[model samples]
Target: MPGLYHICYLSVAKLSALQPTPELGFEAIKEKTRKANSAAGLTGCIIFTGQHFLQVIEGIQEDVEDTFGRISRDTRHTDVRVLSEGPIEVRDFPEMAVNCGGDETLTAEALAEISAVLDYPQHQLHIREIRTLLSVLTQPSRKQDALLAG
Candidate 1:
């Protein structure tokens, strides 16, 4: 009951909120989440790609569950689906309360493929894949930087 637990989920962003710039309203949300999560002793990361959000939250069982519940009710997200959740021996992100990543966006089709993989009966085996994908996607891309600078 009282142990370190983690939950990962994927959700579509409310199109309207994305607005003129997806970061405009979402930056505030991210800051609020970071502060609240820090206060609750939680650590995790959120990856947003203009359309979808993939997040991993880890902490005390109750705290992680409560945060997920609150996020499910948040108006900014839609089609919320838990990708994976269970007790973890250690945290993947121990230092950051919340890390937001969107350097490389995932296509809708790719997201669907990932969701399918994690939804299968042998989903556990693929857990690390998703985490690794998140880690790679989170990294800032020099190619993107160059394009932006050009």
Candidate 2:
């Protein structure tokens, strides 16, 4: 079988009744996204910082591309920009999809961390930075508080 690939992208949310109320809307989106991802045999994580979204998905190339295509056409998002994509020997996230909800302080910090790497030359991001980004996005909420504390 062909190896899986990971694709990361960032997007801004379009104005909508649900978009305006992030807490509720984010959960709704996450729930729907999780269900779809599960059915598609994809696994990864997504972070929503109220206005912006960042997601990393891992799966067969066709499935990943199809999922991304559907996401791009979804009415909820705008300004979709792909950050990175390439084949991987192993899945970084092999289980359930993770949804990192909006927490102002943590979100700001995480965005700053992600932006630094993204601002680098295209596809030139250091492996360490990529791992760090995954760590930041995948940290559980309980551990996230500890992350902020230390």
Candidate 3:
């Protein structure tokens, strides 16, 4: 069996004008994504900062690559830049296809961090920055654990 892998990317959201409302647009995307990811046995989280999207996907190497390829070609996203990716000993989100509903403050902090590093040369992003983003973005997983624990 192939080892586990993950890919993290950031992109700007470009919603079509035809969508009746932003909530509807997001809900549609979330439903579609949930189905697709679940079918492919992939797991990850998607964070939307009102205008941009930060996502992390993990699974078998081929599945992760295939998912990222589709995401890169999707028209709703622009300026899709990968932050980090590599083999992982374990999955950060083992049971979730797409984690959502994060704390507002942490999401805002994550957006600020990503924006600050957006101008930096892609290769120049420090490991610390990547770690920080992962830590904050995965906060929802912790909440999920607590809810299940209770």
Clashing pairs in 3: none
What tens-digit string does per-residue lDDT give for candidate 1 at 39-136? 99999888766667779999999999999999999888998989899999988888788877643354455445545544454654355766766655
Per-residue error at 32 for model 1, in Å?
0.6
After superposing candidate 1 on the true structure, give the runs of residues whose Cα lies further than 4 Å from its correct spot.
18-20, 103-125, 137-150
Select the stronger candidate by TM-score from 1 and 2: 2
Best by lDDT: 1
- Stretches > 4 Å off in candidate 2: 17-20, 103-131
Record all residue pairs in model 2 with backbone atoms less than 3 Å apart, i.e. clashing. none
Q: Whose TM-score is greatest here?
A: 2
Candidate 1 clashing pairs, residues 3+ apart or interchain? none
TM-score of each: 0.74, 0.75, 0.72
Ranking by lDDT: 1, 2, 3
What TM-score would you give candidate 3 relative to the actual structure? 0.72
lDDT of each: 0.76, 0.72, 0.71
Clashes of each: 0, 0, 0
